[model samples]
Target: MWLTNARVFDATGAAARDGRAILIEDGLIAAEDQAGAVPDGVDVIDLAGRTVLPGLIDAHAHVFATPPTPDDGAEPLWPGLTAHFVATGLREALRMGFTTLRDVGSYGDEVITARQAMRYGAFPGPRLLTCGRIVSATAPGGRFFDGMYREADGPDEVRKAVREQVRRGADFVKVMSTGARSVELEDPHPAQLTGPEIAALVDEAHRLGYRVAAHAEGLAGTELAIRLGADTIEHGMYLNQRPDLLDEMAAAGQVLVPTLSCYYGVASGQWTAPLVRLARHNLAEASRTLLAARAAGVPIALGHDWQPFSDAAVELIRLVEHGMTTHEALLAATATGARALGLDDRLGTIQSGKVADLTVVDGDPLTDPVLLRDRAQIWLVLQRGAPVAGAVFDNSAAIAANARTAADSRSVTHTSALSNAGRPRSGTTETPG
Candidate 1:
């Protein structure tokens, strides 16, 4: 497939070009194959006024469905969550232009199932890396968080659980290292795992060929996760409040996923409305910490930690609002996100010979990050060089529609959920890629 008349923008940090084209062969970018650079015997697609870019990757997401009414103050438990529900939302994600996602948490192995389906062409979505269930000790997490967690007491139990998840076809493991904001469905506490336990999860994951993601949001937990070798920190909003630790994470080449929007959403009177004041203060501090880390040479990637709709692009804009140069925010979402997911080798850029996961935008995002926030200006998306407008394209509109429903008016009071209330669910916590 040849995509012509495209303007390519990617993390190479170069200027956006007009009339650029991409040649995709066998689901990989065979070459940049610029405008009028087509080879013999290939189909051509005249983009007509569109810009193309590497497919956008939302590196952190929960490919699980959410319950309609809060989880009745209980962590939403699941043993029956289906892959279809997740697949339902994935169609929307693709339409919204997100070609890939990382499932950071799920109540069960449904995320893994969803990933396999997409990989084998049984479903539609960007590429995925799924961390089975999350292992949370008694110190902090509560029951409402559901099957995603494995409550363990010692290193042995933690190690066993980590191995079990890998055996279940997990691409990675997730662990809860610290306490989180108080919410009804999720009872929050503090650093639930000790240093040894945290270390055990990471060590075992590495040995077993899986990366471990830590849900760390406190000083002790953050430091411990870093020390224990967590591959990524789910919501490092607290890192800004503790620069020393953030600096340490940077120095170690560790990645930080500041689901920066989730915290701010909490402040906006969504779920956990009463804590708005506290969330606000935390938001300011969180932004600063992330900025400091970026300045200090830390690899900061953008993760929505959001349901499909909350304007995922808004998550990137928030980074700019928090002091990241527009270029930095784009990198965080593009090159940085791919690196965080350990997919830098193929995805993240628009260079020749790279996978054709391009995201083309109208003005240079480096000049104005908000340009990315404007979905109307997104132009076109190429997943391995296939247009969103053609066959073999993942239907991402479904994800955007789902997100719109989430951001739209809800008949239920916000009291039933957490901050910035999340995605629509049919009793499961499934988010499309």
Candidate 2:
């Protein structure tokens, strides 16, 4: 497939190229040429001034669970129902152009099952990397809801807990290293696990060949994770207190996945009152700290961290508004995220030999990142060279017919011949919406 005459943000540099053609063959970007030459009989898709970006990657999320809605009046559901909701959430994420995501602290092993199903072509979903459950302390505000976290006391139990997740085939280990806003804590700076306990957990996870992601919000917890060699730091909220720490993180090459969208939402009154109060104080600090970290060369990865999937775009906008350039934010949502998951060689950038997981926007994302948050602006979504959403197979008629239905509903009937829904391939042109 040859995608031609479009502005392409390859995610490897600050600028997008115009009038370039991306040659995709066997789910990989074969070449991106300015001459727009095509082999005989090759399918050429003219993008008509639209922009192509490497499919966005969300570094942290509970991909299997949906955020609570006001109209959701049903009683608590069983595990099966919860899994169903999770699948729905993952679909919404894919339609939003997140072709790759990390399920950090998925409530149970359901993500593992979901990952297997996606691999087997059960349904169209994003490429998922999952950490089965979070490891936390037994103290107050340490352990989260049952199924979401495992409570372990000392080093021995922390080590055991991490091993259990690895045994369950978890891609990584998520450890809660400090208190968060949702927990009932007097101050957020206290570390949940002692230094030795966290060290043991990190060691066990690394030995098992899995990266360790620390859920750190406070200064002490962030320092502990950094000192102990955690692979990624999730929400380093109190990073401003010690500017030197950002240098250490940058020097050590630890990726930071700060879910600024949560605080942004809270400050905007999307969350309830008590949480809003907490977020009001932390939001400014977090914003300043993020800028300092970026200036110090700390690699940032975009994560919604249980925020709605669309908030991933919002997070990128916030990063740009706070301090990062638009290209830096794009790199955070792509290259840095893939690097955090250890999949940079296969995904992330739109370079040759990388998977052709790409998102085509109806407008330039560099001018307005909000286009990513708007469903109508997403023209096409391709996962591994096959369309999973948007106007596939040149079917603007189908997309127009389903215009009233939201991309998040997971009810739009994808044309079998052009999608990854276990269908036959055919010659078709997918145009901008």
Candidate 3:
């Protein structure tokens, strides 16, 4: 397959190269050549100058996050129904041009099951990497988050928790070094786990050939994670308060997943006034930390940490809004994310001999990062050189023919439903896509 006449970003933090062509064979990028270099009889996809990019990646995601209702304190659906919701979220992420998602924390082994399901062709979805559950110090968060946390006390217990996740098929391990902001009974400041405990967990995970993602919100916890060599720091909002930590992270190659969208949701949601206030404060600190991290040369990755997975691209817009240039933000969502997930070699950039996962947008995202959040602007999403989801798959001709046939038969009801079904919905609204 050849994609011709395209403006390609390549996700190398460079300006788009216009009128280029990408050649794919056997699910790998064969070459990036001139538009006229295509051989005869090969499948040619004329992009008509559309912008092409490496498939987006979300480094920090929670695939099984189902916020509870305030009244009943229960999730909206049962476990069985929630699995279906999880599957739908994965498909939606793919439709939005995210070819890979790194789930930092999730309930039980559901993410593992979902990953296997996609691998087995039971469903169409993006590549998924998950930490089976968050390893947290024995705290109120365990009860608050239910099945999402694996609470342990001493260093030995935390090491056991890390081993448990590896046994359950986790790609990496997530450790809660600080209390969560969403849990009302817990504090978000101060290190929740002992230094020995964090060291043990990190050691165990690394010994097993896995990376560690540390949930770091406060200065103390963020510093500990940085010193302990956590591979990625999730929500290191308070890092701005400690320039030394930022320098350490930059030196250690620790990626920071700011997760600005998570705080935005908490501040905007109907939570307690104090929690909302804290979320607002954290949001401000996060903005400052993002700029500091960039200046310190620390790598930043895109992590939405919000619901309705399809709208994850909003993180790119938010990153740009919070002092990052559009080009830097694009790199955060692509190359940096792949680095965070340890898949940079094969998945991040549009290079020859790499897996051909790419997204084609109708507009240049470099000019307006918000174009990434617009579903209609997403023209084609290719996973391993196969068209998985996109507006290009709408088959408008067939839809119109069916509508005309219905109109000729005088079946107005059928024609109306068919026409309406083909129209795209706005925003993060769920669809069969």
TM-score for each candidate, following the candidate numbering: 0.81, 0.88, 0.88
Give lDDT tens digits, candidate 2, residues 1-433: 6677789999997589898888788878999878344554445566765899999999988764663654857566665776676777776787788889888876666888777766766666678888877888875543446677888988999999998887777788988888666766435588878999999999998987889999888788888999999999998977878878889999989998878887877778877788888897777888888888888899999998766765457888888888888889999999999989988888899999999889998889998898988877777888777667653434544433322222333432222325343331322112110
Sort order, TM-score high to low: 3, 2, 1
lDDT of 3 at 131: 88
Worst 10 residues of 1 by lDDT: 412-421
What digit string (tens of lDDT, one per residue) describes model 3 on residues 30-100? 99866774454445566764799999999988896353366857645655766777888888898899988
Clashes of each: 37, 1, 0
Clashing residue pairs for model 2: 64-86
Best by lDDT: 3
